[model samples]
Target: MSQNLYKTDAFTIEYIPGADILKGDFLRCKTSDEYVSAIRAFKEAYERVLPRYTFWDNTRFGHIITPEEQKWTDAFLNYPGAQKGITEKVGILVSQDILAMLSVYEIFEVGKAPLRPGFFANEKQAMEWLTRKETPVAPLPDTKPLIAVEWDADNAKAVIRMEMEAPDLPYYLNRFKRFLSDHDFLVENLRLFQELTRRERKILSMVINGLNNGEIAEQLFISCETVKTHRKNIMRKLGCSSYSELLRFGLFL
Candidate 1:
């Protein structure tokens, strides 16, 4: 049997009868204000249940936290009754979003060493760590996996699906941007490589290995003028202004 301690639009917290564990997760975080309220409710639930072990699954959480809200959370964690010692161990199934992780860190950072919070990438890992057993107890069977789809028409006509948030969001966003740029370059390079003749590809391999026109001509028993013509065509098809620019594709091509 389980006792319901906290119930909100954003979360559901319950206390297990025989296990003496308080377990819950964010249901669907629509707003940052709602997240703050849910945390308050969580504290109230903790005051009543006072479980020895706890687990929070935050896989579906998506909140754009403001700096002022962050300050409130810090203050809430520092309150006299907060983290005064209730739960001995905590296992959290964290969200994939890098920014949502900041909230998890802020909430539990106030706890003493005895609390010993464990962050997990998946529910199986969290449950195993919480129970200290080989087999996991699946608690979130009804919950759906988090998936967000975003299509950028301006860039490559591709779809990128990842819900990002604040507090180091710029760092992750920049990383994604760099990845997109590299992906675009590779796609264009592959298109050019596909358009080349079989002989051009073979010559390109040698050229990419720092072979000059005369060396490539001798190895393939072709004229230097033939190698030069192929080199010119390769650069034209690959949209490279110079040999140096085309040489960058040595590894990739």
Candidate 2:
């Protein structure tokens, strides 16, 4: 059974008991305050429901979080004593826009990246990532210390491992390294933002927004060959050797 806990203009929060998951679907928000309010409501429901895992879909979300809002939100979500009571794994199905994503990248990447959270391109990936748990049977060949946390029967008690670094890049970028499936889907999605020139960014934006070479060329008043060259460069930067890979990566990434 599923319980629709609350619905605001910007988002919806629900408890899906069949999967024992708390789900949040963010539709859109005009401002940071509105986004925070919606998340605040979700946090309240999170305390009340206390599901096993959480999955947040931000596919339709629009607000580009400011730096101050990102810092506040990171602290607000991971408050004192909040780690133990809340669910262990969190999977966020993130926005496709690279620019919009830069904002969210800051929230999780600004601090030490805990092992519990993952960012995915779609719901199936997110849910697949969410249900995954680490079961340490024995020490591996690696020298890194492994800490296995345990919880009570009701799962009201938990010892969450924290304070580990994810990566200098957005955890989303490095998170694919931890995914058991699909090693090839790992893309340098940020390379489009990080490496591209301002003009290239404009061209790449058009490319991701579903424009063809000729169309982008016409809009930007550049030659189609120039657009093609830019697209080729972007594909190279994203580690995509083919157009299909680039298109798929751009659409979902």
Candidate 3:
């Protein structure tokens, strides 16, 4: 059985008792205020209901999140009492639009949130994944030291291990920063590609394939200095700090 927790012109949220999950279906674009209200409602219901409820978000008709809404969501989820240990898992089903998928991906990558989230293209797969029981691990001995050092005869190297009962806040925050930074590079790369001239795209394609500036210049019949200038402009436009970063971003190309 499912019960309606909240509903509006833009969205509907329901609690599915059988699956122990909250389902949020977005029907249309929403204003910033509406979006905030919806999130608040979801949080309130999450607290009021049983603990460890999975969240199934269906955003086939949802709009992209604005920067302001994104900030608010980050703060809300990170609030001390907001969602600490209440959610078990989150499964998000996104629309066909790439931008819509990216918007939802941004939320998951923000991190430090209580939920373990995964994105999916369909509801059935999402549900199956959410309901699957993970193999349990026995708890570590409390008497173990925080850090242990051992000699590995096979590798002929000293191995150091730092054990923790749970991941610290800083761990998740750093992960969030890395995920967002990498995705930001990819997004910028796509935008730069769109802004590039035909000749520039050709040069960028070569660069992505590991061509040196001099090689690109020779192949394109351009001056070496001109190739260097083009490379500089490409880096600037894509906001990549190093050639390696640019190469990683090139995967999207």
Candidate 4:
């Protein structure tokens, strides 16, 4: 058997073969806990055991909306090695009932690009739909012109949504790439933040939260002396003399 890639998060466990989907409250992607667990379960069950993972996403049904929803979707869609078993992965399922909740443009695109091939009302119907081979229709043509792109400097986050027709897609995407390049500082900071040791980051986070040595120790289940040591180490690594300064520089970026 292949070694499990995601043993840490509970979310990943659901997709594993023989996974107890009952343990997962799969109503929707609400919390990080759910996302992490579902990801782990799915990774082990579907992708690892079998050679194909047949699943459905309810995004077209208006299930997902927030950025967190988008993040988890991105994770599952773009997860490393998750596609090993998936030859023809499905992206969205648009039903007549769901169509009423969305727009004409939305349904049109779902019927065009980004829609799953075998979209049915239920999983069984979907499986049957997938069994019968059918040619996928090509994506709709884009003929709109480009305009502008914007990002949130304070949050160091990018939002690509804009009001435009389909033809402007190419220019809009090109502008998005340029926006990403222009915000190199935020990107570098995010990379460094990810690279930092978990404990180090946790300690820095606690310090930024205005916790004293004892409080930090209590929260982390470590001793006060250990908390002091971690504090000093964090300050040294971050090159900050005071907690306020560290919070200002380290947390913002």
Candidate 5:
């Protein structure tokens, strides 16, 4: 048995008892406020269902999110309660519109949500993938994840599709991985700085200003060897591999 859980002019959410999945079909463009409200209603329904459930999100007629809305969506995803372990898998069916598909991809790439997400071209394929009993922990053989986009001048829209075994997955993954690495580096550096001594902090400040070891020692009236030791300690504490890496961390200060 399936039941309608929520609906608006823009979207409808339904619960499928046979598949134990919450499926949402987005019907039209929505203002930021409307989008937020829809998501909140969806979240409420998700919690009412109890234990974790898989999700089917059909956005074949959806609109792209504005930059302001993207910020709001990111904040919502980062909220502690947003991830109540209520979802185990998510299948998103995207529109052919390039901008809309880009928006969907941005949600997956940048949204800080805990979800195992896959992209599909249609509802049937999405349901089949989402309902599978066991998922592979490693990549499948001979296939690659792909995100394909094409510009259609006639319609003034983009034709976009993404799949788990499309050839361009690595390119997208590499870009996202760099973002994660930089974010982690900044967070880790901030934590490590709290452990620095007064003298080390002074030395680190000078190092960040592009001072060489000897120049730092001269400025602080310390021995060159002592400056070298402090620099080494600072690098060890900050997990910086080289001077250039340390400079990158300096941006946070």
Candidate 6:
């Protein structure tokens, strides 16, 4: 059976109250072109989300931080709130393959000694090292793995779905935010739209802006009864009987 990767909340590190940790992804690539593409994508994402995070590029061996990057790290390190808190510490991971190619100076900058930042061969190791001081993370089941979703949009609305089995619901939701933002669909709130015919997406778009059933009916060009039926289906599919519960799903409209 496929194990649930998300269910390991106890093992996953949580953001400290005021510490802003930005995840910079660097996936393994088989070819130079593939590596270039991954680098470009990571760079673009980092720049776009810079305002919200202290970005760290995780590689195979350790983190890659430069003089230019020190400005962001310094700001967070100097923040009174972060300084007084234990959650402000941030680290990076570099792949073992990439580490072998680094120059002595570059490797020195990333390794211990002058730079106290932790290094790891993989993300799980990096996160474990970073969070080791507080509590030891449990061993992860090799079976269950993190899953990704792809969303498709149609005319002002997006249809999102997934197929992986998960152990943690909240983590998957949090992970989806990057996809939502990448597609420019991240919004404040969402509501159950439709249950049958995959109308939940349309309803989410409408409800995120506080649309009532009648308004949704008009916008969707359906009768009030039909809209109600759709709502019922949505509630059933989502396992939520109340509008409040539905909104909490946080679908970006």
> Which candidate number maximizes TM-score?
5
lDDT of 1 by residue, 41-105 (tens): 77777778777677777777778566666556556643433346555567676676656666555
Tens-digit lDDT string for candidate 5 (138-184) = 11225544669999999899998767532134335446667898888
Where is model 6 more than 4 Å wrong at Cα? 1-19, 51-90, 98-117, 121-125, 128-253
Better of 2 and 6 by lDDT: 2
With a 3 Å backbone cut-off (N, CA, C), the pairs that clash in candidate 3 are none
In the predicted model 5, the residue pairs found to clash are 98-158, 144-165, 144-166, 145-164, 145-166, 146-166
Q: Give each model a TM-score.
A: 0.46, 0.51, 0.50, 0.31, 0.55, 0.25
lDDT of 3: 0.64
Every candidate's lDDT: 0.68, 0.66, 0.64, 0.47, 0.67, 0.44
- Deviation in angstroms for 176 in model 2? 16
Model 4: CA > 4 A from native: 1-29, 57-65, 68-72, 75-86, 91-118, 135-253
lDDT score for candidate 1 against the true structure: 0.68
State how far residue 198 of model 5 sits from its true place (Å).
Answer: 29
Best-fitting candidate, measured by lDDT? 1
lDDT of 2 at 104: 71
Candidate 2 per-residue C-alpha lDDT over 145-212 given as tens digits, one digit per residue, 9 for 90 to 100: 34567786696898744332222224434353345334444353544446767787677678777888
Model 1: residue 60 alpha-carbon error in angstroms: 0.9
Which regions of candidate 5 fall more than 4 Å away from where they truly are? 77-82, 135-253
To one decimal, what is the Cα RMSD in angstroms of model 4 from the true structure?
16.8
Ranking by TM-score: 5, 2, 3, 1, 4, 6
Which regions in candidate 1 have their CA more than 4 angstroms from the true location?
A: 66-68, 77-83, 106-116, 133-253
Tell me the deviation in Å of residue 79 in model 3: 5.3
Where is the poorest 10-residue window by lDDT in model 5? Answer: 136-145
lDDT measured at residue 129 in model 4 versus the true structure, 0 to 100: 43
